[model samples]
Every structure is written in structure tokens, then in C-alpha cells.
Target chain A: MGLRRIDVCGLPPPEPLERVVEALTTLESDDALVVVIHREPVLLYSLLARHRFHWETTLRDDGVFEVRIERRP
Target chain B: MTPGPGLSLTQAPPLSVPFRFYLGAPLFALLAALLLVVQGPDALASRWMPEALAVTHLFALGFVTQVMVGSLMQMLPVVAGAPVPRPQLVAALVHVPLALGALLLPTFFLTHWPWTLYAAIGTLGFSLAVFLFAITTSLLRASAGFPTVGGMWLATVSLGFAAGLGLLLAPMHAGLVSVVVGVRHLHPVWGLAGWVGLLVVGVSFQVVPMFQLTPPYPRVVLRFFVPVLFATLIVGSLLDTSPMEPYVWSLLGGEFFAFAALTTYLQQRRRRKTRDPSLGFWRTALLSLAVCSLLGVFRPFVGLGNTARVDTALVILFLMGFAGSLNLGMLLKIVPFLCWFHLQATFLGRGPVPHMGMFLGDRAGRRLLRVHQTALFLLAVSLLWAPAHRLAWSAVAVDAVWLGTLLVLATLRYRRAVRALAAAST
Candidate 1:
């Protein structure tokens, strides 16, 4: 499945997180998401785990971190 | 400032000169490589024209090696999810000293200036220290399950050894070492093949796929090439110090396998929709490599008639064709992307931002590509059948023009990107 890109800033943390999960679950989309996170968001790992997402993270040379998450089957 | 929806502040901002340095470095190296071809076989012999040594060092130390160092500082983290330690400081310290050392090394050797040699050694030493720290820090931070990452680590270690070997020999110009066997023979091979060659191959394994958007290299090619090259280099170096025919075989075997791996990867590339200019560069390079390899095999039989010509050809092929061509092809892609990527990131969500395609500036690139191709053609022809001095000098003239034009275009593009970012910031 093709990937989608989403940003995690400005919005309240869990709101965007929950919205991502609910949108994916409702549509049952198999698409993956590439998320851009600035600094380490508090409880971000648990929130992802609670939503049962699989993710890989990269910390770029420029100090920004990108986290890729794929929807569960 | 509202970042356009597709853009984000989180995108990694590209460093201007580091990126420009990476591009500019290779262009300068290409200029030097072409000059060597025009200057003929005397360039390689230890007789050492001040100009020739300056140009050679320009490519080896200033251009080729400099590009690799700058590129790794930027790329290693992106590929390996690692952070370079004190990266700005590393870049800030290394670039100027290395350039100055490269500038002075030729003068020192030419004038037989003791102080200049000392200065060269000191500056080169400082640059090497920065390189070592950059490589070590990046490796330590890398979460290395990746083969490319492993290859880079090996290359970095090899580079350290090569630099040390060069330092050990530098004092020999004054006959201080008492080490009779010419270390010069080992220096180029160690620096070019062992250090620069390994790094290029390792990065190409990732970049060819990433940029061309092609499939992964064949499993066997990736898995075996690195180990085989490593084994051969070790065994061959040992043999250089001993009396072993088996080590010679090992080295040749390793080189042949490298050729095979490169060929396989290029053949399988999927970006075959049209006649790519990059392919033209690569084809010349590959042909050069093949010729150089064969010359190595026939070194003992180079006959007095062919000795000068063959030696000249080998150096030209390796330096200009293999290293220079690959650098040109990759830089064309890298420079544009850095421009588009950084520009787009700033305007993310706020307004319309141009796509990568829009930012490519094909008209400008085409002019540079044409000049580059003309220079390459003239150089190859000059190497092949140039019985006339005029023809050879013409090749150098064309190459110098090419470098000057490239530097201008790259500078303009860099300025454009910076302006775009500044405008967005305000």
C-alpha cells in the first residue's frame, strides 16, 4: 500500500493520535503513514502501542525525527 | 507562517555550503582528473611538476576526499538514524584547513620548502582528526542492521589507516624515513582504492536504488562483495610485504568480483525509460574501469612502447571515468533535491510550494551537462590518440571551462534556495 504523510504538531497530541487510529480503523485502510515528530512527545510510544501500530523511527542528521507507522491488519 | 499542508517544520534543513561543497568538490576533482589526462604520463612519475602535484592533490585530497567527507557528514545520519557529534564544528574546522593544505602542498613540494611541508602535515593532520571524529561519532550512534552502514564503517576505518600510511611517508621527501621501498606506490592505491573506492561503492549500493527508484541490488552482490573486497585487500597488502602469488590472485579476484557487482547493479536498474545523461557518464566510467583492470592484469607485459600510454590510461580511467563520472551523475540528482526539499519544507502548509519536478531547473542543468559531456569527450579523445600537444591542451581548456560554468550554476541555485527559505521564514 502507498504511504501517507502526516504532521504531529499544533494539534493536541492524543486528539491527532486518536483521529489517526479511528480514521484508519473505520476505512480499514492498509496504507502506511510517515509521521514527523519534533522532539520526543511525552507518552508517544504508549499511545502508539495502545493503538497497536507498528513503527520504525529515524533520527535525521539535522536533528529532526521521522516515525513511520503502518496500520495493523 | 502557516506551513503548507504538505510541508512541515520538522523536515531536516539542508546545510548550504556542506551541500554545495559536496557538489563543488567533485566538479573540481573532475577538472583535476581531466588535467592529468592532458598532462600525460609524466604527471604520475615522482618527478613532480608543482602544477601536476597541486592538481593531483586537488582531486585526491581537495576534491574527491573532501566530497566524501562532507557527504558522509550529511548522509550517514539520514541513512543510519544516527547523529553526528558536533557536526557544525566538524565542518567549520575541517573545510578551510584542508583547502589551505591542498593549496600549499604543491608549493611546498615544488619549492622544497621545509616549513611548507610542516604546515601541510599539520593542516592535513587536523582535517584527518575531524574526519575520524565524524566517522566514529556517526558509527557509535548508528543502529546498524543495514549493510550500507556496515560498509561505511569499514571504509572509515580503512581511511584512517590510509591517512596514517600517508603521514608515515611524508617525511621521506627529505630522506628522513630510511624506508627504501617507495611508499608512494602504496599511497595512491590505499587512498584511492581502499579509502575512496570503498566509500563510493558502499554509498552507490544505497543511492542507485534510492534515486533511480530501482529495486534492491541482487542479494549475492550485496552480501559477498564487501567481505570479498575486505579479504582481498588484507591478503594483498600482506602479499605486498611478502612473497606470495596467492595474494596476487586474491587481489585480482576481488577486483573482478567488484566489477561483476557493479555491472549487475547497473544492468538491473529500472530507470530505463529514455537515454539518460547519467547513463552516459556511467558508461564512460565503467569502460574506463574495465580497461584499468585489464591493464593491471597485463602490467608485467606493458612493453616499453606501451608502458607510458598504458599507465596514463589506467590513471585516467580510474580517476576521471570511475570516480568523476559517478560523482557527476549523483550530484545532479542530489543538488536539486536539496534545493527542492529545503524550499518546500519552509512553505509547508502556508501556501503553494513547487514540487520537486518544478524545482529541477532542467534548462540550467542541461547546459552544465552539455559542458560536462563535451569536456569528457575531449578528455577521452585526448587520451586515446593525441599525438599533438595542441589537442591535449585543448582538452584541459575545455575541462577548465566546464568547472567554471558548473561552479557558477551551483552557486546560483544555492542562492535561490536560500532566498526561498528566507522569504518563507519572514
Candidate 2:
């Protein structure tokens, strides 16, 4: 399984959301996308679930938000 | 394929539900300014004047509270991950009674019509009870530890206390029961400092970062300060009822100062590379908050001028300057963001989608913020020179109209964009 990572920490809002959506569309079934952001993308959680992407998010002690997503079977 | 049971966090209410409330809020602001225009300087003379009561409630119930209801409905599911059941029905039910009651109560205050007051009580009370119960139930079901979520709980409790006191006052106003004059202070104390204040603080924790591109508030402050603020308000309320307190007011003043200072610090530390129109509103608001807190410190000692005038000025500073400015700032950001978001959701991968930055005209936003600042400046002048009150109200009316026009334009553009994308899709 390949792990793809994207860091959107310094990017503006819609950019981060757009990049993640793009990544999801092109991602392979075995691959998981890891998104590192400066703050929690609260809106994305709903969108991901609606699109049937199982995801996990945790805020690191370093104060960055990390979200992992993969297509659900 | 439909996902069952656990998809509650993913449920987004129809955008129309929140948009309806947003649209109502500006119209209420228009009503408030026009009411002030009709009432003239008398509205600014004493907080007890019938016109004063009307205008105050109009802003509190109709505008400020209206926006809060809409924002909470939008945020509860998306931000807190707690979905309201039948959000559209709930919005419809609350909006009707709340709007009508807000209008009628002020009219009753001005006219002293018993039936009007009674109807106002019924509708306003029902809406508050339903709203509080609905929101609180959903918030409680969410699992814990987000400071934003915790702030909502405290603010909700404060709303209950504030609403109860406000309702009880109606009977006293109607001569049904004798009420304590000192206890009357509890209504605004919990309502403004408790309900409005905590809610703002809670939302700020999330918003400053998202919209302002600020860093997260210090974790310790987030975890502890909101509850601390709640404790101070509760104690302050208790002391108002007690005769033996020497420092009750001062203690509350201290907490407010700390809050104001912390918020100012947060604003200063924001990392956004470009300046936005909303920042002007926010900076003015933070400055007003800091000034209000300092004024509170010396208010008891200032051996001041007319008591009624002083009280009115405090209200203006706290409500319009601090709270209202922040509300407008968020509206500028959120309204455009939502318009873009809902329209974007309908976009099929056909034509190039419009950028979020273009959703709201930057020049138009800057102009409205200028109008708002002009209104605030005029209000401050009105506080000092009574003759300027009419001009202040006019400025406010213009500001409201400007904002309403912008919101309407954006909504239209959003609709047109959605239709174009739909046609292109097939």
C-alpha cells in the first residue's frame, strides 16, 4: 500500500479544500492520503463522509491538524 | 449507496435554512435604525425610555440574536458534528415567533397594549424555549472536550437564565407582580456578558484562525478561560442580588479586562499576509472592548456626568461597538463563504468554477465596512453631543441598507452561477 502525503499548512482555505478533493479523485484504492494542515478543516469531515471516504483526524501536540483518508469499500 | 446510522456528522442542513435567518437579520437592523430615526435623540437619552427599550430589544432579539441563531444552526453540524433533527422545520418555527415577538414586544413597550405584551410574551417565550431545548439537546449529544463545544454549553445555560429573567420582567411591566429593581440587572448581565459574550468567545476560538488566519488560542486559555468567564458572570449575578458585596463589580471588571487583553493579543498575532475588510471591523471591535473594560474599571469612580447618559453610552460601546462590529465582520466572511460553498456543491466538473475570492466584491465589502465605521464614529459623537443622534441613526440606516444590498447581490450571483453550472453539466 502506498501512502501519499500532502501538506497544506501555509495555504489559504479553499485551496486546501480543493487540493484534498483533487487528491481523493486521483488516489488509488490501496493508497491513503495524509493531509497536514495548520488548523482543523471542519467542513471537510462532512464532505468526506458524504463522499464515502473513511477518515481519521488528530491534532498533533505540535498544534497541526493531520487527516488521513481512503476510499471506503 | 446510502450509509446508515453513523452519518450524523455528515448531515448538512439545506443552505436555505441558515440563509433565511441571515436575510432576516439585516432587515431587522434596518427596522432598528428606522425606529431610532423616528425616536430621535430620545432613544439615546435613557435606557428606560420606551423607545430605548424598543430599539435595544430590536437589536438584541432581532439582529444580534438572529445572527447567532443562524450561525449556530450552520455551525452545530459542521463544526461541532452534532446535527439538528429537522433543521428547516426548527428554523421556520423559531424564525416566525422570534421575529414577530421581537417586533411586537417593542411596540408593546412603546404603546403599553396589554394584548400586545401578552402576545409578545407568548411568542418570544416559546421561541426561546424551543430554541434553547433544540440546540442544547443536539450540543449535549456531541462527545466532549472541544472548548468551542464547552463554550456553547455555558452560553446556552446563560441564555436560559437571561430568558427567564426577561420573561419574568414582562409580568412586572404589566403589573402582575412586584419585582426587585436590583434583580432586573440580572437579565442584561446574563444576557450580554454571559450569553452573548461566551458565545462570541467560543466562536472566536474557531473563527480567528479560519477567517483571520490566526494561530489557535493558547490551549490553556481555551481550556480554562471560558469556564472562568462563566464563573465570574455567575458570581456577578449573585452579587447583584446580595447587599453585602464590596468588590462584585470590580471582580467582573477584572475578568473583562483579561478577556479584552487576551483577544487583542490574539488579533495582533494573526498570521494573515493580506489585509481584508473584516479586519477593520475586528480591530475596531477589539479596541472598543478594551476601552469598555477600562471604562468599567473607573465607571464607579469617575464621579461621572448624567447617569442615564453614561449608561446609554456603555450600552452603545458594549453592544454596538464590541459585539455588533464583530458580528458584522463574521457576516462579511461567512455570507460570501456560504454562497460560494453551496453553489460550489452544485458544480459538476464541466465549466471552470468561480473562485471563492470573487464571490463577494472586495471593493463593495470595504465600502460597507467604512460605512459601519462612520456609523460607529457618529454614534460616539452622538453620545457626547446630543444633536448628532439623528445623523448617527441615519448613518446606521445607510450601513444596514448597504449590507443588505451586498448580501442580496451575492445571493443572486450564487443562484445564477448554480444554474449556469447545472445547464453546462448535461
Candidate 3:
């Protein structure tokens, strides 16, 4: 599956966390998800680890956070 | 790279520490409401009345301060990355005595009893000292440099001063230090502004954006606001019954305007589309601040003939409208959220955790909110027109019971869910 991008910027905390969760659940083995948020979702990293998924976070120049996720192979 | 184990869910104090205080607050509020019912408009007469003194200490020390202290204990570890040492010891020492002092100090004021006054001075003074030292040291060790930390720091300072001043003033009733002991304005001002207002504003910096999906508060305000407010409070306290009263008013006027303006702007920018009771409560508080600050600043110019009436209006607006509404609003959010957090963390892999919303449930929370709103409206009206006084007192009594019940039920629901999970696991 192609990558899915979920925008959680400007949304409050649990919303960003929830939107990323929903997006992650919808992705297939080969699919990937990208989350755009205002702050680093430090807790999300642990959550992904719990689900045995992998994520890489990159800080954009604009100060927004972008987290990429996919199932671990 | 492997995902790092950043912090455990257990980083915050065991839910019991905060929960004990949270559960205790409504009980105190209930006591205050019952006291109101007993005294009626007589207590509402003026700031100088014994009834007024009793009610103020009950609400300030017993309810609002308890919640603030409890929340700080919870947040210091999790939010600020500093955990108070020997938290259970801290709780026992702080909570029990505070509750005792709330009852005794107010009794002393109402009854003019020397024993009660002395007991209040002893209990409240000791509890507050322990609270300040434990909290401040823990904060000093805190690694995180969040704005909330600064607020807490100054709040502790304010609390120390307020408590000291309170202890000093206690003797006046006992005929110990005899001269009018006019630091009365300074005492409550520091108590309300330094302790209550600072903590509220400080916690808002973190909570408002996260819980409500609002933008971060301005950096300048976060960095400079609390310190300046603390300074002004100290100066005002020292200038008690002085000619510099006008300058003090100016100092406070500027501060309130800035706070109200920032709070209003940030609230308006909140991303939520639907209505929220917390927001309604906050709006009530902010409006009270805005209107009252204006009135306060120009009181010298505009002759509001009845000092007692004006003082009563300001107290209700500040204590009930601002502090009380904000206290309830935050408690509603924090209680359910803490339940959800603890449950989810506990049962992450073991079993199905209960739905977070099921703890308080939306309908119940909304109903509770309605009760508070109605009570607040009646109380505000009672101040304007004397006839509504009994109605206001009765409504507040109901409101207190209503809030306590909702919170207790929420806690029960949380415990039940956890028990069910354990049953399924085994």
C-alpha cells in the first residue's frame, strides 16, 4: 500500500496521538504512515515499540514534527 | 535504532497520592457550602465579618490549596521531571494537618475562641512549612526547565509569606498584637494572587494547549509573568495600609489586564469546535478578572458608596467566579484523565482496559457542569440583589454534593474497571 499522511498539526495532544494511532492501524505490512504534529510525540515512540512497529522522527525546519511509521520486518 | 524507553507510566506518583487530595477537596468545598447555608447573608455582609473569614479560609486553604498541592505532587515528577522525596510521608504530614487547620482556623474566626486560634496557628503553620520545604527542594532538583516550574517556585514563596502573615494576623483575634493588624489585604491578596492565581496560570501554560488543543502561551508571559507578579505581591504586602496603595493597584491592574488578555486570546484560538464546560468556566473566570480589574483600578475615581457591598462583589467574583470555577473545571478534566492514564498504563498488554470516557462519562460530566453553572449564576446574582441570597446558598450546597458524588463515582468506576481486568487476567 502507498503511504498515508495524517495531519495533526495545531490539534491538541490526545488528538494528535489518536489520529496517528488510527492511521497506523489502517496501514498494511508494506504500507507506511506519516504524522505531522507540532511537538514530538515522545509517548508515541514507546507505543510503536509496544506494537512492534518502527518509527523515525524528523524535525522540520518550520519547527513541526513529522513521524514516519511502518511495521517492523 | 531501537525505540528508547524514555519514561515509565509510573513516573508520576501512584494515583493514590493525588487522588487522596482530589477526593478530599470536594469534601472541604462541601463544608464551605454548608457553612454558607448556616450563615446566609449575614456571612456575606462584608470582608470583615467572622462568617466571611471562616468561609474564605475554608475555600482557600481547604479546597483550592489542597488541589493545587496535590496536582503539584503529581506533576512534579511527570511534567517537571522532579519527584518529591518520600511522597507518602509528604502527603500524610501535609494533608491531615491542612484539613484540620481548615476546620479549626475558621471555627476560631467564627467563635472567637483562643484555643481554636492557637490550634489553627500551630497546625496550619506546621503543615504549610513542611509543604513548602518538601515541594521547593523537590522542585530545585527538577531537571526540566518548564515554565510551570517557575510558577510553582514563586507560588511556594507566596504561600510561605501568606502563611507567615496569616500566623502573624491570628494573634489579632486573640488580642496579642493589638494594632488593627491591617495586613489583611496583603494576606488574602498573596494567598489568592500568589498561591491560587500563580498556580492556575502556571498549570494553564501546560494544560490548556495539551488538553484543549490550543496554541502555546506566549514565551514572554511564561518567563516573566510569575516573577513579576510575585514581586508586586510582596511589595503590596509590605505596603499594607500605606499611601502607596494607588501604585500597588496600578501594578496589579497591569498584571491582571495582561493575564486576562493572553488567556482570552489563547482560549479563542483553541481548536475545539464543540462546546466544553471547562471553557465556559474559564470564560466566566476571565470575564470576572477583566471586569473586576477595571473596577479595582478606578475604584478611587468612581465612588462605589457601599464598601461592604463592593468588597462582597469582588470577593464573589474572585473567589467563586475566578478561583472556584477554574478549580472545578480543571478537576473535572484531571480526575478522568488520570484515571484513564493509570488504567491504560497498568493494563497495556495484560487485558482490555476500560474506555477512558467511561470513567466520568460525558453525560454525567455535562450534568455536573450544568449544576455548577446554575449555582455560580445564582451566587453572582445574590451579590447584586440581596433577596437571592438563600437561593444562592442552597444552590451551592447542591453543587457541592453534586461535584463530590460525580468524582467519587468516577473513582469507583476506575477501581471497578481495574478489578475486572485483574479478574479476567487471572
* Top-TM-score candidate index: 2
Question: Residue B352 of model 2: what lDDT?
Answer: 55
Q: Compared with the true structure, what per-residue lDDT tens digits does model 1 show for residues B1-426?
A: 111122212123246536645645645554565555566545554324455556667767767677667677767655665656666677768887887787667667657788888899899889888878877877887764446776787778778877787788778865677753435555666676667667766766766664444566778867776656666666666666555633463356347446645664665665543445565555556666666666666565434365655555665567666776666665555555555445433443333434333444445445555666666566567666565334554554565456446545655665675676567657
Write down the worst ten-residue block by lDDT for model 1 chain B: B1-10
Docking quality band of candidate 3, CAPRI definitions:
incorrect
- lDDT per residue (tens digit) for residues B13-66 in model 2: 777877887777777778888888887897767887888888888888888898
How do the residues B325-379 of candidate 3 rate in per-residue lDDT, one tens digit apiece? 7877777777887787676556555576666578776677678778877888898
Q: Which candidate achieves the best lDDT against the true structure?
A: 2
lDDT of each: 0.60, 0.79, 0.77
Pick out the ten consecutive residues of candidate 2 chain B with the lowest summed lDDT: B1-10
Candidate 1 regions with alpha-carbon error over 4 angstroms: A1-73, B1-13, B23-52, B241-250, B253-265, B268-275, B301-309, B354-360, B363-367, B384-397, B400-404, B417-426
Q: How does residue B165 of candidate 3 score in lDDT?
A: 75
- What is the number of residue pairs that collide in model 3? 1
lDDT of 1 at A33: 72
lDDT of 1: 0.60
Docking class of 2: acceptable
Give native contacts recovered, as a fraction, per prediction: 0.00, 0.12, 0.18
Arrange candidates, best TM-score first.
Answer: 2, 3, 1
Q: After superposition, how far is residue B212 of candidate 3 from its true place, in Å?
A: 2.6
| Per-residue lDDT over A6-72 for candidate 1, one digit per residue giving the tens place of the 0 to 100 score | 6653342223444444434433357777666543332334334444556677777766667776645
